[model samples]
Target: MSYGLDAHTIKSLKKAQKNEITEHYIYLKLSSFKKNRQNSQILQQIAQDELYHHNALKKFTGTDIKPNIFKIYFYTFISVIFGITFGIKLMERGERNSEKLYGELGQKIEEFKKIANEEDRHEKELVGIIEEERLQFVGSMVLGLNDALVELTGTLAGLTFALKNTRLIALSGLITGIAASLSMSASEYLSARTEQDSSRALKSSIYTGVTYIITVVFLVLPYLLFSNYVLSLAVTIIVAIIIILVFNFYISVAKDLSFGQRFFEMAGISLGVAVISFIIGYLVRLFLGVDI
Candidate 1:
């Protein structure tokens, strides 16, 4: 499989290679950051995952691949808005190619289909991406749910730490979680409904709402598991870290990236959040002399 590749697989393989390179570059760029062992371990895992993806792709396509540094450079130079726009454009291109790839493959002989290993074509893929993007209109509710889930869980954990009563914590968690959910759901629904095609938005929003609620329940379960506030808080953080790591591994497996590389990337993000939040919380407590 070294030189000649089916046009569809070529495109898919190119995209995969380019994405791996981009993640690798991003990881390398963070080399200057002062990281602890846990964070370093995560990055290593993520990088390894990316490498595995790259290698598996090369094995399948048999094409000698090179890093697309120019694309990476362009991405780094772009403003945040333009960067997202660029990503959308790439997604558009990928959707078209994928649709073409899959659609053609659908009509081929079963033997050919087995070789191609895909069923959808370029136009279908393009439409799918478009629909996915547009459908997020209702997904505004989903995103709101996600935000509430993350922030509220973190909030409940922090509050429980500071105020060590289960009934009190339950009341606070209930008020905060419900309020956050309502506010988030309303905002999501309203924003999504504003779109021209609500079908996509509606489906996306519903899926999002369901998924986010599921994630929130999982995040909050530690509190129910342990009666002690401090223990529950600790358990919550551990569970979150485990979930995030597992998610990283699953994503890596899907992309053929090694778990190690994905772990590192996720670990870095988690560390950044934990450090910033801890500093803010610590400073507030110091100034206010609040007891936990």
Candidate 2:
């Protein structure tokens, strides 16, 4: 069944076919990891749909295509580490160009339109129903992460100027960070207890504490590694911004939020507090006449 397609069109169709087959395998692999019967069934359905799309494209190209093995393994590893919802959503976002191509091709071919519509409607509905514990406690993670970024960044910046010694700054920041993380965890536990059961609340507090400590370790590492206090502080702020960028991007993709807005807002608040703390540190050092 020759559609009288040009070489270029056929090539593009083959690429799309490969993508569909790759995702079919990816979804199939991911479904096996799901313990929830409903979630597993949903993934299985999506995998079948992807397979159907691959065969549909193959008809136009009149050729066999291999699935991308690297993509299948990469997304599977990501889903295992980060949770299935995030990994799947990340993969779907990467397919936006393919979806656009389908839309363009749909104008010329009726079959492409049907495939495009199914991709847009059915798969999304299936993915939306997937439940994961990490996502359920995302708010706890955010609370811990945000507080650590703002409070610890400001504290470290203040210590950097006040101490003017890398070792001293790191020591002070570590103590402060550890103490703050414990306090935040306890507070979160109490707060969550009011809204949910004790077991879930405990889990929430653990997530909060672990996330806070992780952020603290990253922020303080620069001071430990670098001798120059100024450079250490500079690196710490850069690290803080990077943390914000990465976390916001994850949240944006997994939760379908606006990346730019959340990223800028969090970055602005954290850096602004750090700057204020730095000035305060200088003023306090000047008034106290401390020499280290």
Candidate 3:
């Protein structure tokens, strides 16, 4: 059930967790100064990563990692929390610290130089930061939710072609939402576990699962409030459009895509999907004639 922990692995994990916790504290502290949606979301995301590192350390060592308990009164928190900003400033200041680290720092860590695989060495350095996995999964899951909100909302909207009863409408929505959420989450978890690449797996699962759930959940909301199937459908479609725009904007801004490119690309893709889903649903209705 347990394997002996390597000293180097232990050291790497400890440093990573310490860095994460310190970063978490900095974000929490930042909350005192500003209250923007972007800042809040970023801070929360960063906090999730820190917690994840702590959890990973626990899994590896079967011991509680208390960042606060490490040192009674030490200020190495600078590297943990401020290292990222420092790196950013270094680049901003137009000085390539890359030379110093690879040339000088690599020489200092002679053991690292002995490792045959340069890639492995880079990977180890990458893993030395604990907050990475957390940032990746959590952020991706949020995107998944956004996708659900847009797509499933569109589904129910298009489904208005079926029947007119509000009960049926709400019932349809309830069915879709619950089913989508459970199915998506389960599928995501399974897929993620099976994946070899941690970051890729997390991103795929979160994006797919969350989007699936959100789309289904919103699809049914109109039925709850309106008796007219057409009206519900119309509102759902409108909501879907709004959601799509928001989702597109989100990806664009987050990824630094050109506004015009993001707009047309997202619009084209979404419209195609919507059209296809609508066609499929309509054909099914015509062939089956609502017997089920």
lDDT of 1 by residue, 27-51 (tens): 3443223145454454445445455
Model 1 stretches astray by more than 4 angstroms: 1-146, 245-292
Candidate 3 C-alpha lDDT tens digits along 1-292: 2335467655654554554455455445543333455544654555564465456445655666555533312322432443333222222122122222223324544522332233233223333332333234544554465456545554654565655466775787677767776677667766676864766765666666656666666657777888887787777767666766765554443333455665666556666666676677777788888833
Cα distance off (Å), candidate 1, residue 27: 38
Give lDDT tens digits, candidate 2, residues 84-197.
888999999877877888898899889989888988985478557888889999999999999999999999999887889999999999999999999999999999999999
Each candidate: what lDDT?
0.52, 0.92, 0.52
TM-score of 1: 0.44
TM-score of every prediction relative to native = 0.44, 0.96, 0.45
Candidate 3: clashing pairs of residues:
144-210, 144-211, 145-210, 147-211, 148-211, 148-214, 148-215, 149-214, 149-215, 152-215
Better of 2 and 3 by lDDT: 2
Candidate 3 Cα errors over 4 Å, as ranges: 1-135, 142-154, 196-211, 283-292
